[model samples]
Each structure stands twice: as structure tokens, then as C-alpha cells.
Target chain A: MTQTNTIRVLVAKPGLDGHDRGAKVIARALRDAGMEVIYTGLRQTPEQIVEAAIQEDVDAIGLSILSGAHNFLFPKVVELLKKEGADDILVIGGGVIPDEDIPGLKEAGIAEIFTPGTPTSRIVEFIKENVKH
Target chain B: MDLIQSVLNGEKRGIAKMITLIEKNAPEAIEALKQIYQHTGKAAIIGITGPPGSGKSSLVNQLTKKIRSEDKKVGIIAIDPTSPFTGGALLGDRIRMQELALDQGVFIRSMGSRGALGGLSRASYDAAKVLDAAGMDYVIIETVGVGQSEIDIVKLADIVALVLIPGMGDEVQAIKAGVMEIGDVFVVNKADKDGANRVVTEIEMMLDLNTEKDAARPPVIKTIATTGEGIDELNEHIKKYWHQIANSNELAKRRKERIRSELISITEDHILNQILSDKSSKIDSMVKDIYEKKIDPYSAMELLIAPEK
Candidate 1:
């Protein structure tokens, strides 16, 4: 929509969770869908994620948290981005998020939450449709 | 074109743009680097690596300050982990050295690991070369402190400083033998903490046990990174080691090895990209077969290379 060539996305895993099969799958899927995805690997902190988003000038940040520390980590990421005046960047999350906690996460400025079974196509479409730049 | 020319002339923004281009893995970036490659190799490259919570960023920040105090321009590449979902980076290390961001003499860039195993990014060596050619007095690379994989830093830096903090518990013991051997200097940070001395002693004992008879003994320095204690002494020791290496031809030998390593890494990346982008139906069918277990990965690879065979 913004006339950009590719939608740049930063896919990160926060805290100590080492499982990355899902993350890799999503990255490959996004790339296949003509998006530019920068996979940061595992064990990234909130600060590292924000700094990367700033430098990469990405359109969206997708945090995959399976470590149950989402409450602690996601807020910090949002806070840092806000502090850096990067609030315009879309923030979304996935990875074992519970149904009960979705509202709280959404209230914290997360644009969307995709669960484990969500199709990669749907994710790609959502990003392309919603993210302006 | 002017940007590329300025990069060749060793200007700061030009260097930053070159690194950004390289990290993007753009086609033109390679040409830009080739143009500037010959001007590289003047700066002292030091790698600061250790496990998370080892205070590597703080040490790098302090070292940058110390290096600048002596009127030396510094280029720092702090590698952060990339985002798995979005394929971006959360570069927290920049937060540690935010003050340096405002300094005209210091250039700091945070690079994402991009999931490249062995602790270093594929473009890191090239980026360092860009900094070196940019006329920085020193180039410091800080890695994400992830055990043995982090030892890859040794291949890129003239001096490798391993930072260890107090109260890491038994995690310190889990550092691989490869990491233990590559350290040219050891730092015990957070010296104000309770177990600082014990960590220092343990490192000393480990050094004594593992080092060769002819190898120079690596010095361990203690520091409270938050307050900048012991940083000046650490800088002095690092310079002392650098002078010794320069005078002994060790620096030249190390630089040769680093260049060789960079060539190998770049070639590997090129070959892999080529293989993936070759656009042959045979490779695709082979991958599908491998996924279906009709053939093993080794056989698939062999089949993919059958044209050359």
C-alpha cells in the first residue's frame, strides 16, 4: 500500500526459549510470500529487539515467546519502542499465547496475536493488508 | 556514487551506509566493498565476547570511551540476536553505549546475528573491514556471549577479550574448551559484587592449566563496569599486548589468518546462495525427495551436485 517493494519484518524470540522450528517456518513462509523477513534467532532481549527494529527500519516486529515470560518481555519491548518514538511500527506476537491472556496483550498495544495453528498465508496477508509501510 | 566514493575515502556516514548495504546482502554492496577493500587493514580489531550477563557491552562501552580519550576514533560492531518471527533485530547493546552515539569521533553499529551459527554474522568481517578502511583507529566487535560458537570472534579480531561477571554460578564452567583457549585477555566485570575475586581466581587457574608453555600469558583485569573502575588499566594492558604483537610479527600473521578466514566465509556464503538460487528443477525435486525420505540429505546434496560430477 505504501508502494514499497517488500514488507520488512523482524521476527524475534525473547528470553531463553530455544525452540525455533515454528519461527523458522514462519520466516520461510513470509519470504515465500514476497516479504523481507530478518530472523534474529533465539534468546533475544527486549532491548535488542527494539534496537534492531530501529536500525532495520522494519514495518513490523513479530515476537515469538514460548517461555511464558511474554508479560515481562512484551511490555518492555513496547515501552522501549515508545521511548524511542518508534510507536508507528506495528507490533504483533505469536507462540503459545493463551486464549485468556489475549485481551491483556492486545490492550498493551500489540496489533494482533496469531496462535500456533494460524496459517502463514493469513499472517502474510494480515501484514500486507494492515502495515502501511 | 558519492556515498561509495566517500566510503572509499573512509568517511563515517559512508562506512555506515556500506555496512547497511552489506547486511542487506545486496548485489551492489559487494562491488562497493571490492572498491574499498584495498584501503582496509589499518585498524586494530579487538573482539569482546562472553556469555550473556558477562557485561560484554559495558566493557565495550568503557573501552570505546578509553580509546577515545586518547584521541583515537573507534568503530564498534555490537552483534544482537535477530527476531525469529519478524526477521528483524532488537539491538539492546546500543542502549549500553547510547552516549557514544552522540560522539562525532565514535561510530557504533549494532548488527544482528541473523541466525548464523558460530557466533559471528556472515557480513561481520566485511563490515569490520569497512570500518577499518573508514580510518577508525580501533574496531571493536562485541558478540552475544553464547559459549563455543562465540569463539568465532577470534578469527575476526586481532585481540579477543573474554568478559566474565561475578555470580554466573556454574555456567562459567560450561564454557567450551575452544572458548577458553582463544582468549587473549580475560575480564572480571562487576568487581563490586561478592564473588568477583573467586571468578578472577578461577579464570587464572583455568589459564594456568590450559595454556601452552610458549604462549604468552593472558592477563585478567577486574572492573566495575557501571562506574568505569579499572577501565584505564584494562586499556593500557590491551595496548601493551597490541604493541607486543605489532613488534613481534604476530599481528601480521594474525591479520593474514583473519583475511583467509574472511575469504572462506564469504566464499561459503556465495556458494550456498548460488546453489539455492541456481533455478534447477533437479535441486527442487531432490529437496522434495529428501523431505519424503526417498533419499537422505547427503544423497540429495550429491544429486544436486551431479552436474559437476
Candidate 2:
């Protein structure tokens, strides 16, 4: 069953990553899945991403980081979300994250990590299943 | 009436509504802006722009913290790319600056480029005006930073910082001529990267070569925005530029130019819309005729512009 309100997502690239093909692909996939997605073009800071999520009243925030700055960037985003009273938002990530770092990311409150090759359907389904209206 | 009053009182919903109205070019929004126009001019607008990978958002986050430390209210309007097919904005930049969301003194808004020719959303101008009228001490307009169109920020900001990063191959050449010319302050962000000094030197050389008699030579500052290094100096430079603009006649002249440009844009849009609406069928027929070579496009245009005989 289709939900009455479309889930809003803020998909962003953090750090100096110039590779945004994945971000663009995901943004398109999410839009195709009947969600409203805001794609911050590239080189966003954690602060800018979170600010956008809150301003757009997005239900989820997805960050794509490939610049090897995930260790520093993800935690900062989680911290900012907590401070902003937006902990309710489902924070997810995708990029060149290693499997070993996934645990630390989860521990830091990132709801999920969808690596490269993860199906867009899975992302849509995960949000549909987890995000509370 | 309530919308106008609420906007003047700085209500968020009211401000949002006014922006929507302005974006649609609604008459009421024009009236509301007229009413609140006198209350503006208090906000110091800073434009953050650079090549796409220049870490502008991170720099903005650092700037936000520095500004907040001074007990000033800040507003940020980040322009994100809109999907060509779906008309949706992927608001990725806002996620980078989430820390300030909880700050009562800070307000952030993200806009979609929405296929606008100028790389900025048409609504961005009105949104900035709304933030200005809402009593923000500082308003930062961050563009997607793709060349020519990104230069629009110069018209909207009191201080424009052009951010650059090392390791972007041929960055000096990649930098748009328009953005290079408009930058009031140059920032070599991600300065911890290799060849950071080289980037700074290159920027300095460029600045030296480009300095004009009438324009102040922009300073190039090295910053590692991620770690907040050199942010204070950057902030100080921004303030100094603001003060310089305030103390001189340049600010007034700039504002006049902005208003003039806005007027021209509005008139153009209005005339185009009116013409399209009034002669939709005729225009379609003319287009079809031109496509079939039944009439030349120039004569069709002449007929369209000529009053009905």
C-alpha cells in the first residue's frame, strides 16, 4: 500500500569527494520509488547536511562519503543530529565504507549502511519499514 | 494581512509562505515584500561559493560557529540540485551543517536549483529577503558552485568568499572567470592537503594579476574547515569586508544594481508570461508554421509583436 505522504530524504556527499555518480543514482532511485529526495550536489559538511534535513523536515538523512573522511564525518553528523533534537530521523550512509567500520557507525547511531551495489529497492524498503510517520 | 504581519514578526511559517508566494510571483507576496522592505538592510549577507568540491559547506559550518560565538543570529540558504525529471531537490548540503539546527539563533533553509538557468533557484532571492527581514544578523547564501550561474551570488551578498581546494587538477583553469572576478575573499580550503601552499600561491598570483584600481584586492586565506583552523581569521576578514562595504558608497551602489537587475528580471518574466498567455494558440500555430517552413520565424516574431490589425 502506498503511504499518503511521501517520505522526504536528504541525500548528501560529505568531505572532498568529487565522485557523486552513486549519490545521483541513489537520488534518482529514491525519487523513482515515490519519495521526495533533496540531493546536495557535493562536498557538503556534516553541518550543512543536517541543516538541510531539518529545514526540509526530512524523515531520513543519507550521506555518501568516499573521501576516506567517514570516520570523522559520520560521528560529527550523528552528534549534530542528537544536538538538534533530530535523533528521530533515520540516519543512513553509503559509500566506500569498510565492513569493519560499519559496527562503529552503527554504535554511533547510524541506522544502516548501504554500501555500493545495494539495491535502491532495499533502501526504499528499509525506510518504509523503519521510519515512523 | 495576517501573513504580512506574521512575516514582519519573523514567524517561520509566515516567512516560508511569503517565499513560496514570491517564487510564484504572486501579487500578494510582492505587496508583503513592499511592506517589509524598509525593515530589511540590517542583515549582513555573506556568499559562500567555489568549485563543486571546494568544501564550501564545511567552511560555512565553521563560519556559523564563529558567528554564533559572537552572539549573532545566522541564517543559511544552501542551493542544491533539483532533479530534471522529478522537480525534486536533493538537499545534501544541509546534512553537513546540522550542528546549528538546535541553536536558537540560527535558521537554515535549502533550495533546489529547479532547472533555473542561473544555477540558483528563483526563490533564493526572496528567501534571503525573508531571512533578512526576520532579523538575522547574518545571512549566508551557498550556491552549488558551478561556474557562470554561481556568480549570481555576488549580486546577493555583501561579502563574497570564493572557496578553492588543492588537488583539484588544473583548479586555476577550472575556476570560472566570472566567479574568479566576483570573489571578494579567496579561501584555499582543505589546506592540509598536499600542494595546499601551491594553491594559495597560485591564488595570490591570480589575485595580483587581476587586481583593479577601483576594487580592493581580495585576500586569500588558508583554511582546514574540517578542523576549524584559520576560521577566525576568515570570519574576521568577512567582517572587515562587511564594514568596508558599510562605510563606503559601494554598498548602496550594489543594492541599487541588485534592485535594477531584479526589476529587469521581473519585467521580463511578466512580459513573457503575458505574451505566452495571450497568444498561446497563435504562438503554437506560428511555431508549427516555422517548423514546416510555412513562415519564417523572424516574420512570425514580427507578427506576434505587432499589434492586432
Per-model i-RMS in Å? 8.8, 7.9
For every prediction, compared with the true complex, DockQ reads 0.05, 0.16
Q: Model 2 over residues B107-147: C-alpha lDDT tens digits?
A: 77766676675557777888888889988899999987665
- State the TM-score for model 2: 0.74
Of candidate 1 chain A, the 10-residue stretch with the lowest lDDT total is: A1-10
Candidate 2 per-residue lDDT, tens place, A1-133, comes to: 1112446777888899799999889888887776667776677778777766665667788889898888889889999989977788898999999999999999988899999889889988998788856
Superposed Cα deviation of residue A65, candidate 1 (Å): 27
Off by over 4 Å in 2: A1-28, A33-54, A57-133, B23-28, B171-176, B292-294
Worst 10 residues of 1 chain B by lDDT: B83-92
lDDT of 1 by residue, A26-85 (tens): 877776665667666678878777866665567788889898888788878898999977
What's the DockQ of model 2?
0.16
